[model samples]
Target: MLRTDEILSTIQMLHAEHLDVRTVTMGVNIQDCASADVEAMCRKLRHKLTSRASRLVETCDRVGGKYGLKVTNKRLAISPVAHLLSGHDLNAAVAVAKTLDQAAAEVRVDLIGGFSALVHKGISSGDKVVIDALPAVLSQTQRLCASVNAASRRAGINMDAVRLLGEQIKAIAEATADRQGFGAAKLVVFANIPEDNPFMAGAYLGDGEPEVVINVGVSGPGVVSSALKRRLELEPNLTLGELAEEIKLTAFRVTRAGELIGREVATELGIPFGIVDLSLAPTPEIGDSVGEILQLLGLDAIGAPGSTAAVALLNDAVKKGGAFASSSVGGLSGAFIPVSEDAALADAATRGHLTLEKLEAMTSVCSVGLDMIAIPGDTPAETIAAIMADELAIGVINNKTTAVRLIPVPGKKAGDRVDFGGLFGSAPVMPVRNPGASSRFVRFGGRIPAPIQSLSN
Candidate 1:
């Protein structure tokens, strides 16, 4: 703990590799804010959120500045809005969403998550309200994010919920077509969704969590890549096993740094520190890509034969490092490969080096599934459901977290470019090999039984 060289090395790496905490997310349990009356419920939501998170931004900045670190985003996640919307109608759902946007804006947070529904087994009335209102909710709100859990190991997959979400995603895109389907980017469909995820579109305060908590997302694909590159420069013949060890060490430092900052912020805010999500979340920025790390790991192309294995190695090393660094490592603590958000992956997709099928295979190993990938607007709802069914099947069978964040850009076709700009980035729409071929399969809609793994005692 007293090694000056280690401290200096950490400092150097922070600046040199563009390392910074990705997000400081404050989770507030708002289940107490529920009411049958729409206006009263919205009022409670506003008061609860504002009172709980008013100082989140200020605290993140002050704490980060103390350590010469930058907290890229200060965000908020509430308990599932579905609970608050129970016994409410679609209009009430819209009202709750608007209230969230307003409250988050007033508190000056970047995004507000937890507009979510857990429909893994079946959709409750509240879940239905949230689902039905998504097209309007997403189209009209800027800072609001939503998630729907349609699959889980214990409950199998809710094909009904999946089919609804597939259709609604199209509706959401057409509702916001003027913005090139950017609204769909704010939604994530999940299997075995995490309660404390600090990442956007999927974050929410799950049941049994504390009343209020602070979670941090430390994303360092760039940092990991830089360390690998430096090591390779010195010894060009190091084996993949050796490289994974290096990744673990680098992840250890990153996780420690993240937890340090997150705990400090939590202490200042008078709430418990939740976890450090050590996911290697990437951006469109050059040098800050997960795909670049894959390239550095001797993959000539991202979606080649060895891509899945490389991702598995990276994801495993990261989890091991984070687990060793902190007992508080939760959320999706692995390497992310969101296509549009990672420039290298996006370029690989544009160049035909990556395809939907390849991306699905990699998600079997990576942290998240089919993230930020755009497809033709004309893609069938049944096909979208099939895509989700396949990814969720992976999670349900393996008992891990996997999600889909696909955008079907209106009026766009496969191979056409759709620029969402900013961190949402852009991608050339990838073709769904057989658009409506899966209609019958997805149409035979019933729960896909959970694997025998669910019975493990």
Candidate 2:
């Protein structure tokens, strides 16, 4: 039970800080909707999603309004579409994506995920079809987001899938050249991807998830930043250790708020409540930034020498607090540093303080990797794959979840600006170092075996 004073304090946070439920995603498993007949499958999928998610937005709004808190985005995540696309052609794969887009529109959700494939070991014929159709499917759809799991601790890295995705990303960028490769922004490639994540571009209903569940994403980078500021004002002599504790305690409160809101909405919808993902997901707004939190933690810039250490500390503390606060905590519940989505991180990139190398290093300790980063138009596909391979390697070896959402902006060179607007935000195209140098390495398309540590069982 939440104390009256705690509720009041949470209300204060809503007004004083950029505190809000980032997303309430309904994961609807549609594996049962699969059919060899493409038309039949599409019909079943459309009906299922629409019927299941029909009341999602209304319920979220009603619950949030009751508590005087806003649910920023209402979303949906389905079981991997590729799994349902078995025995289907590329054309059928694309049609399924369009169907998903239509369902999301009818339900009025912010985004719909699970146009995904798990190819950590190898790509299936169905997965191959989905991958091939991504350029057109992503360019044609607005609400549909896609993800591919190309690496995992047990299966290591599927360089074949990585190679294919690199080419597909390039094709998707070209397909959406009118929008400066905005299509790539809707796609993520992952290593050890989580099934229960409520965030877009990476969210998917994992095979083990319930037929229907509601996962809540809680974001409070601004709240965390503001708390640190107040604490420093009160105790100017506090050390880093003490500051970490403060961040942890604040995260606990944030997680609790999310859990309370999530359970209420789930109960109202008659759906089982999922986990609270306490990720310090930032926004383009000036104050609501994970980068700002880093600055408050004594970094002059986000890509500075001590940046990785700062991120490691922040991630550890967030996970610890979230775990303690909610036994049902799941998903990638840590700080996200998407370059374009966070204004400070974008500025850091423009200032040359946040280079690709530095960002990659930061991903080793952060929630996700290489997110929403735009590189020069001419950057080679092999370079993009190499970047993904490096990030995935970290996750595979460390047994963590990491992902890449790199957009090679079409017709844009290094230092050129491109605006995706809305939640997608904008960023200057950063140059890929030694652009074509990794072609030979990436061309070795095969599997990289799992490390010995994967034998933990």
Candidate 3:
């Protein structure tokens, strides 16, 4: 039970600080909706999604209002669409995607995830079909989000799938050229992707999850930063280790608030409460930026030296606090440094202070990898594959989740600005150092064997 003082503190956070539940995602298993006939499968899928998620948005709003908390997004994550595409072709995949879009619209959810394929080791026939259909599937749909897990700790990296996704990302860019290749922004290429993440475009109902579950994502970089600023103002002599402890305490309160909301939602929906994702997911809004937290940690700029260590400190403190607050903590529960989504990070990139190399280094310690980054449109497919390989290798070796959401804006060159608008934000197209140099390396398509750590029993 929260003390009276604690309750008032939370109220202050809600009203003043940018502290609110980021997303309340409900995962719905759709494997039972599959059928051998394409039309039958689509019909079943549509019915299942509609029946399951019809009340999601309403319930989220109702419960959030009950607590005076705003649930920014109500989302749905279904089982991997590749499983539903068994014995299907590209046409079937597109049809299924359209069905998903229609169902999501009818249910009034913000985004519908799980138009995804998990081919970490090898691509199944269905996985290949989904990959081939992505350019059309993503371009033609608004609310549909997709992901492809091309690497894992045990199975290592699937260079073949990586190469395919890189090629298709370019195709997706061309298909949505009028929208500045915004379709690519809806797709993520992941390594060691978690099964229970509440965030998109990487969320899916993994095989081990329940038939239906509610997961909450709590994001408050601003709240964290404010707490740190207040502490420094009050006690300027505090050491870095003491400052980290303060962060943990603030995160504990945030996670408790999120869990309270999630459990209430789950109970109302008659589903199991899954987990609370304690990611410090930032936005384009000022003061609500992960980069600002790094600045508070004394970094001259986000990409300056010691930035990686600073991020590691913040990520670790957040995780420790969330874990202690909730035993069910899961998902990517750390700092997310999506470039365009965070105003400070976007500015850093625009000013050339944060290069792709520095961002990659930072991802080694952050929650996600190379997120919301806009690159030159003409960047080579091979080069894109190489980028994925390098980032995924970090996750594979470290045994953690990492993903890439690279948007190659069509017709835009380095230093040009591409505006995606809304929470997607805008960014200057950063240059890729070696445009076509990785062609041969990425073409050697095979698995990069798992690191020695995988041998642990």
Per-candidate TM equals: 0.98, 0.98, 0.98
Please, what are the lDDT tens digits per residue for candidate 2 over residues 1-457?
9999977767668978989999999999998898989899999999999999999999999999987888999999998998888788888988999999999999999799999999999888788888989998999999999999999999999999999899999999999999999999999999999989999989999988899999999999988998899999999999989889989999998998899999999999999998999999999998999999899888997799999999998998999999999999999999999999999999999999999999999999989999999999899999899999999999999899999999999889999998999877889999888989999999999999998973665
Provide the lowest-lDDT 10-residue window in model 1. 448-457
Cα TM-score of candidate 2? 0.98
Q: For each candidate, what is the lDDT?
A: 0.93, 0.93, 0.92
Off by over 4 Å in 1: 1-4, 454-457
The local lDDT score (0 to 100) that residue 443 gets in candidate 3 is 95
Query: After superposing candidate 3, which stretches have Cα over 4 Å from the reference?
Result: 1-4, 454-457
Q: Candidate 3, residue 355: CA error in Å? A: 0.8
Give residue 155's error in model 3 in angstroms: 0.8
Worst 10 residues of 3 by lDDT: 448-457
Instruction: Give the poorly placed runs of model 2, Cα more than 4 Å off.
Output: 1-8, 454-457
Tell me the lDDT of model 3 at 431.
90
Per residue, candidate 1 scores C-alpha lDDT tens digits across 108-128 of: 998999999999999999999
Report backbone clashes per prediction. 0, 0, 0
- lDDT, residue 382, candidate 1: 92
